[model samples]
Target: MAATGLTPSKAGPSRPSAPREAAPAPPGGAFARALRRNLTAHAFLIGAVLCFAVFSWYPMVREFFLAFQTTENGEVSWVGLDNLATVFNDPAFWQAWRNTLLFTVLALLLGFAVPFLVAIVINEFHHAQGYLRLLVYLPVMLPPVASVLLFQYLYDPGYGLLNELLRLLHLPEQQWLQDPDLSMLSIVVASTWMNMGGATLIYLAALQGIPGELYEAAELDGAGLLRKIWHVTIPQTRLVLSLMLLMQVIATMQVFVEPFLLTGGAGPEGSTTTVVYLIYQYAFNFNDYGAAAALGLLLLVLLAGFSAAYVRLSRAQDE
Candidate 1:
């Protein structure tokens, strides 16, 4: 070679020209890869999306439309706020609201608290825990209708087992489901018994996830049981508690079966007639689909608010 400045010295092979810049990734190929990934993702989601659209979203949209429209003699027509006006004007409307609110409050008091307490107690136990869990969950597996009917029999003022037990204790037999003041309470008690199992189980799982070191630390600091629970347990389980609170509120707000089957939906002067039951009456009893849909929309709004609160609380918890 001509002894040119090209003495094969130091820098090795010039890095092969940087591998030709990867051929610019063939824009179409990159797009195709992304498209394929997105299609696969969407394919996995399509079933659930369709299910939600068909069952939940579609019904919600239909309910919205029905709220503003009327169908009489198979003729559907837009009636603006007439349906809402009818729902607002009905005397039972406010009563239903009041009853629903009361039920939600009572359900929180009983349904929310009892399960948490039961879960705490069960979590503390060292023996027969599984059996107790099964016992607690048994009522949940029962058919709701059967459970309601059973409670109805137990609530019978004249011949019910509950009254008989009261009589045995030398207490006066009182009307349970028949008394307007007690009817809602009675229904709530029945509902709590039937539904508390699921909440209790959830609480149990949450409790199990709580590190024992927290409790030990509290105990080492001379914190008593109640103090440990307040400072440690409650704080640790706040997210679950808040979530359960919202769920119980939403569920009790829509209560229909317990009151309906126990006290015939109206419940001794509509004492137990919830908004859902009112909607049922409007739809099936009066054959007023528009009014029913309007009332249902109102309930849906309320539930949606609760759901939003739940989602916010959940996000906060995750953070």
Candidate 2:
């Protein structure tokens, strides 16, 4: 062999140097490409952004401006807290708040709790689940006005189905929408019937997602039905429950249509009058937009706080 240090070793003919493959271009290179991508994404979002701006943001901003301004003979002038003062000074303000509070309490007791309970019961059924679900949800599919009008007729004191049933059961006749003491409760029942389906469906979905093993473990520990629900069902579904509670509070606080259509907006002795109905009266009946906006602003603040709490709770659950 020639001197090993001086000669190249030959295993075979040296393979021709392999051509280097070019690296794939960075997905849209960093700067201009990223800008282009952002522009495209924003372009796709533009329609939704514009819709929210026009319908949601603009209305909210306009309401805030309108709340402090007054129009006299078509001339608008800023009046600061005068509009707010007018709302505060209205004789119906406290009564409206009181009635609204009562409606909210009744709605929570009936509307919020009943749906969750119904959902729980439905979750335990082994047969005809679909039929039951349809039965529960069918009312939600009906037009709201039609449902309200139907409930209004059903609540009539004389010659109504409810009274007929009561009579058959030997129960005393109820004035329903006509009775100051019973009107709000009657509206709560109607509103609950019309609205509970959505909440029930949501609760049902949440309940289904809960691990069956949890209930098995509870039962293995000798937990009874109520104890199993308290330990397993409620704990597992607490997040959904809390969210629904906040939503119900916000919704019930702003109730209007039920009372409006069922009881001529105020009911007997204004027992069913709500803050939203008061706003309606100010805006339409009195043509006092400023006062309406101011009252709406107050309601908006309260709802905003509830919404914020809901968001916080949701985020906590996610974390």
Candidate 3:
């Protein structure tokens, strides 16, 4: 080997002087890395992807498309905003929206309050906590059809347990299901029994996570139970409460089964025709898929707005 002034042995042309620094990865490269990691980390993602693709993405896309088109003799033709305009012009839309809101408000008033109160009290009670939790969740485990059918007897206008109880107490028997005014209210009550159980258990579980020291500190500060609840309990459980409120906004918007089974799909004089029920009537009763899809899209938008607002508020609080 001839070595003079450290001449390099030419296995190849001396490598070009290296760049001073390496180029940074493109923005999308990070995403690709994350995708690979997540895919390699879990096998469940494949099944989840397939399920979401088939059920959620496919239906949502088709529904949006269907909203703009009507099927005639197995051919689809665009009707533009006609479906939406028709839905808006229909008197039933407003009626259904009103009924849906009323049901949600009534449910929030009775359903949210009673369950929260019960959960807090139950959580505080020392004895048989597990047993009490199980008891409260029993209604949630019951079959929906069974629950609705049982309420049918309870809501019977005549010769029902509710009316008999009223009579025993010298109270006039009011029309529970047959009267327009009371029909929604009756369904709300029956549904509250089913709904409250799940929410109450959720509250109970949330309450368990809250530090007992907070309550103890509040107690030391001469805080009464209500004051402590206002200062400590409510604040501590605020997230859970907001989550439940959002859930109620979503679930109550889609009120169907109770009204469907109890009030014969429409309440007395069409009082309980919720937006979802209206969709059902349009799709199944009149075979108006376009109108149904339009109405459904509108409902989805409204619910999404509510959810977004709640999420923003919640994030602000966390910050």
Candidate 4:
């Protein structure tokens, strides 16, 4: 007998599976078992959704239904577009609409552009960035009442600090808050001061995220500062800018508090009568919930159009 270089094997040539990749080890002790409990997770998620439906969606749907219904003495009745007809027919509605448009446009020009430019400037400056940020954000921490009251004093017709400063610098002492023509402008200025801080912070974050290398390369290729910003920074963060613009338009379109607090709902000659103020008047002063809800729906439709446009733009960019 002779021993050969062979080993014992099962019949049929010992076929075996190519090394079975280790089964992803079942997650591990208690944590793994808990995670696999889909019933618990699904139950919790459905409960959360139901809560939202009850609290948010139900209220919104109710508002929609009420928009087409009339109420008298705390009782509601179906009116079928009478509220819409009334809203369109009312003279005040046009005025409110005009004021809302004006506020939105002015705010974008005065508020949005300033913060964006300031963000760009701050991103460039090596010194005072933190100091300037803190200084700008300080207004945000101030209560709106305190801030408005402070502005009232500053815009006072007599012995105001700003008037004195204007006097000292040889600038005309304009009646800021009192004049009907100047009242909306005054509110815009105040709101801009308060609102610009957060916007500036968002833009600054976006600006900082832009790679310095892009600018360096652009400069190396003889591109100037404006060109670099136009070509590089603008394109790089256009999404954030568009998002902020939409938000600012929506927010500024609903300007109410500043005008209400500053000018007592409507300024001299109804100059600062914004849409939101009008809605508040309908809902509270006149007890016309239907009209208020109708106006709200109008705003929702307009802003929804803007949001839909944004979604399309985002999707186009992704593609």
Judged by lDDT, which candidate is best?
A: 2
- Residues 27-115 of candidate 4 have per-residue lDDT tens digits of 67877667676768878999999999999999889989989999788787999998889889988899988878988888888998999
Ranking 2 against 3 by lDDT, winner: 2
**Looking at model 2, which ten-residue stretch has the lowest summed lDDT?**
2-11
Candidate 1 CA-lDDT value:
0.89
Whole-model lDDT per candidate: 0.89, 0.92, 0.89, 0.87
TM-score ranking from best candidate downward:
2, 3, 1, 4
Runs with alpha carbons beyond 4 Å of true place in candidate 3: 1-42
Residues 136-162, model 2: lDDT tens digits: 999999998999989877987888889
Q: For model 1, state the Cα shift of residue 179 in Å.
A: 0.8
lDDT of 3 by residue, 1-319 (tens): 6555544553558768867887776567877778867876556878889999999999999999999999989999999999999999999889999999999999988888999999989988988998998888898899999988788888776878899899999999989988998999999999999878889988998999999899889888999989988998899899899889899879988999999989887778999899999999899999999999999999989988989988998899799
Model 1 Cα lDDT, one tens digit per residue, 1-319: 4654565685368654454444455456777878776997878799889999999999999999999999978999999999999999999999999999998988888999999999999999978889989999999999999898889789988889999999999999989987898988898899999999999999999999999999999999999989988999999999889878877877888888888788889988779888998999999999999999999998888789879977887888679
Off by over 4 Å in 1: 1-44, 306-319
Clashing pairs in 3: none
State how far residue 251 of model 2 sits from its true place (Å): 0.8
- The per-candidate count of clashes, in order, stands at 0, 0, 0, 0
The weakest ten consecutive residues by lDDT in model 3 span 2-11
